[model samples]
Target: MYKIVEKEHFSENVVKLIVEAPMIAQSRRPGHFVIVRIGEGGERIPLTISAADTVKGTITLVVQAIGESTRKICALEIGDCFTDIVGPLGQATHIENVGTVVCCGGGVGVAPLLPIIKAMKEAGNRVVSILAARTSDLIILEKEVSEYSDEVIIMTDDGSKGQKGLVTAGVESVINREKVDLVVAIGPAVMMKFVSLTTKKYDIPTMVSLNTIMVDGTGMCGACRVTVDGKTKFVCIDGPEFDAHKVDFDEMIMRLRAYN
Candidate 1:
């Protein structure tokens, strides 16, 4: 049993949990995720590792209660436990000193992007982060992300935050003002698709993290399959991160709507 040592609500629908997982805490890298089950016969859900503390033997998970399984997990209290927690899975993000890097995150995607921003800054890159949400209250981890980023831009669909625009506009604004070597985007499928389009115009190398319907958290299920450069790829083993320009977002987005 993995005990929830701490819990905090980021928004009405989003919760952050710090759980006891010493092994995962010590081994997890940026871009790694875990498959969690609430109890016996419970549905498995995959979540990206938001942060980890080896000394505390804990790993942080940020979950938005978008569905049944996620709601169950989010409803748990600090002392509650997850019946199963499996991972440090998926390929780690390739970190390099790639000059100026712009990291774009939307909604709960900001949680997973935080660690990457920190790692990019540490690797000797000038990190600029763009965080977006529907409104100010929906934005998570602004202070934490800002700590590692050289500059942080906030975008919201409504004019309730730093800039009243889409995340893509923020990315274009930065790209127009200066040279950006790499762009890392994580968010809704539509948001990522447009972000990819925007970056492709500038010919900047862009990477995106995909959240697909995953079962078994292994390649055996074939549930997380995606097309990259017109070929089949498994998100579990091959990547949760892929070259944004090469991914078939339209097909992937359709697959995601299967359950909806």
Candidate 2:
């Protein structure tokens, strides 16, 4: 059992938990995720490792209570335990000195993007981050993300904070002012789709993390399958990160709605 060492509410529906997972924390890289099970017979769910502390033997998970399983996980208090937590799974983000990199994150997607921003900056790239949410209340990790980023832009649909516009606008604003070597976007599938489209116009290389349906965290389930560059790839093994331009977002978006 992995104990929840700390817990904080990011918003009304979003909760952050720091869990005791020494092995995973020591080895987890940016873009890796874990499959968590609450208890016996509980549903398995995939959650990205938002941050990890080797010395503390802990990994952080940011969860938005969107459904039954996530809600259950979020409802647990500090000192509670997760019955099963499996991974450091999925491919880690490829980091290098890629000149100027823009990391775009939407809602809880910002949680996973934080580590990548820190890694990029450490790799000697000028890192710019864009954080977007439906409203001011939904925006999270601003202070944390800003610490690692050279510049931070906030976008909200409601004008409660930052600019009153979509994340795509923020992407274009940066692209127009200077050259961007790469863009890493993680958010709703639809947001990534449009971000990919926007970057494609400028011929900028972009990467996106796919949060798809899954049963087993392993590829055997065939639940996280996605089409990339016209070929089938399983998110669990092949990638949770893919070249944004080549992914078939339309199909993936439709697949995400299958249960809804």
Candidate 3:
């Protein structure tokens, strides 16, 4: 059992937990995720490892209380223990000295992008980040992201925070002025789709993380299937990350809509 060492509420609906998983923490890297179950009877859910501390032996996860399992997990207190916690699973983000990389994150997506941005910075890339939310309260990790980013722009739908617009607006501002080598986005499917579309026009490479309905965290279940580059790939193994330009967004979006 992994002990919950710390917990904080990011928003009314979003909760962040730091768990004691020394092994996982020691190996965790950007873009890696884990499967967590609240108890023996609970269903396992996949959550990205937002951050990790090797010496401290802890892994941080940000959970949005969207459904039954997530809501249950969010209700646990700091000292609570989870019945099961498995991973630094899946492939870590491919990082290189790609100059002028733009990382776009919206809402809860900000959590997953934190480590990715830091990795890009470590690789000697000028990391520009675009953080977006529907309102001021929904925005998270702005200060943390700004610390790693060479440039950070915030956009809100209600004009309650920094510049009133979508994240794409910030992307457009930067894209118009500079030569962006790559763009990485994580957010709602619709947001990612549009971000990919926008970058595709400029011939820049775009990558996105897909939250397909996953049962087993392994590829055996065939549950997290997605079409990329005209071939079927399982998100569990092949990717939670994929070339955004090659993904069949229409089909992916349709599948996601079914959950709503």
| Candidate scoring better on TM-score of 2 and 3 | 2
Pairs of residues clashing in candidate 1: none
Judged by whole-model lDDT over C-alpha atoms, candidate 1 comes out at: 0.96
TM-score for every candidate vs. truth? 0.99, 0.99, 0.98
Per-residue C-alpha lDDT of model 1 across residues 1-260, encoded as one tens digit per residue: 99999999999999999999999999999999999999799999999999999999999999999889899999999899999999989999999999999999999999989999999999999999999999999999999999999999999999799999999999999999999999999989899999999999999999999999999877998999999999999999999999999999999999999979
Clashes of each: 0, 0, 0
Reference-based lDDT, residue 227, model 1: 99
Considering lDDT, where higher is better, how would the candidates rank from best to worst?
Answer: 2, 1, 3
Local accuracy of candidate 3 as per-residue lDDT tens digits, 18-87? 9999999998889999999977688989999999999889999999999999999999998899899988
What candidate 2 gets wrong by more than 4 Å, as runs, is none
Residue 244, candidate 3: Cα error in Å is 0.4
Q: Model 2 over residues 52-120: C-alpha lDDT tens digits?
A: 999999999999998999999999999999999999899999999989999999999999999999999
